[model samples]
Target: MITEDNDPRKGKRPDPRLGSGEAPDLGGFTMEDGTVTFDWTQTRVRLARLADAGPVELGRRRRFFVARDDLAGVKLEFVPPLVQAIPSTCQSLDEYLNWLPEGLGRHLIVLIQAGASALGLWEEDRLVAHKAIKKYVVRGHGKAQPTYLRSKGKSRYGSRLRLRNARSLLVETSEKIHEWRNESGPFSRVFYSCPVRIWSGFLDGKPAPPLSKEDLVKIPLDVARPCFDELLRVRRRSLVGRVRTLGDEER
Candidate 1:
């Protein structure tokens, strides 16, 4: 009958076995009656702060949480380089989905940019498929845009060029998504992290494809590097079936 509080060992180190896959600790949850719930409130706050911190600060915070008494038995589960929450406005995405009736969706993690996109087909927290868009232009740089402005159709012509680029980018992205579905998709929803302005352009611009209910999560474009690193980490860790597993736009 070990309770959450009152332990004299308030900052003991976690068990090394907790993350070795030999009886790994997957954190903990509370169950009352037949319902199970995880207290993500504090975890979400911690994650938000971590998302804004630098490498040195991140390490400091990680070490702090790793010694909490409440997390003593499961500290390793939430630590960085494992599976971090990576703060999002959609922090409650998974929780909201859990409230649905049933069979409504699957987990999908996407990292998007104006120039590229990465899609991950996740089964729960495990990534089952990976897809990417190399270099698609919504709008080009320098001479990529026409230098000459015709007197007759200058504005209209420029609009058409932009639209053309947008459509091309959209078509390529949709094709990849469609291929994923055809191969093994029909995903329930997408937890996407992309620049806010770029995403808005994609959605608001004409000839855009439709998205499902509450799918996109607008994260700053600066987070792309760290996000990609996190994805690679997950992929490498998943190789063993056991192992373990943002920034910039605010200026």
Candidate 2:
């Protein structure tokens, strides 16, 4: 329910250094042209101070806003109460387009989470192609056990299984990245955001890594949900390791 009218710039000066990136000239902190901007550093600190601070609720998304003050300082605000701020997940190319800023053209956006991931290609704010994948779960439920009798076997096994799956998923994700480049058309730029650990272990690796230090954009995990959901809608097509492009019949 937050709106532009609540922008702090009208009344007070924002923190000048709030969102300056490693290289100030980069557009990461720019708020020009109605572009919705997010600053993970200041946002995280302020979020931790909120009384309701904790993990985001199930099936919801969170957003942090950064506004420019009249003096050029930066103002930061998040959707209040964080728990009920789910803006609804993007389900179609049009829906996803609505969430992005105007003037984006031929850019690749990839998002990865612990259990799911998504990749999409957009040109002039129109979705050209996309791919999404959902990791399968083998076990269903678990029962409480006494701490003295607790076993690490099940946890270790699950970790190993997930690691194996993650390795395979990494390869598939890399393939899609290449396809977006060589097959779809030459994307002007690529923006991929994910957790540091996930990015390092899988994406920042040898023989066709998905991202480089210069291109990775660090973002909150909550922001990753919609990307995951956007891809989830196309999981069926991606299962066959093919890129889903415009006008293609649904499988």
Candidate number with greatest TM-score: 2
Runs of candidate 2 exceeding 4 Å displacement: 2-102, 137-159, 210-212, 224-251
lDDT of 1: 0.40
TM-score of 1: 0.41
lDDT of 2 by residue, 71-109 (tens): 423332333211112234644223432443323345566
TM-score of each: 0.41, 0.44
Model 2 poorest 10 in a row by lDDT: 236-245
**What's the true lDDT of residue 241 in model 1?**
13
Each candidate structure's count of clashing pairs: 2, 2
In model 1, residue pairs whose N, Cα or C atoms come closer than 3 Å (at least 3 residues apart or on different chains), thus clashing, are 81-245, 82-245
lDDT of 1 by residue, 157-237 (tens): 555665466456546666666666667756656555655665665566444534655554333223443244555433332
lDDT of each: 0.40, 0.42
Compare the candidates by lDDT and give the number of the best one: 2
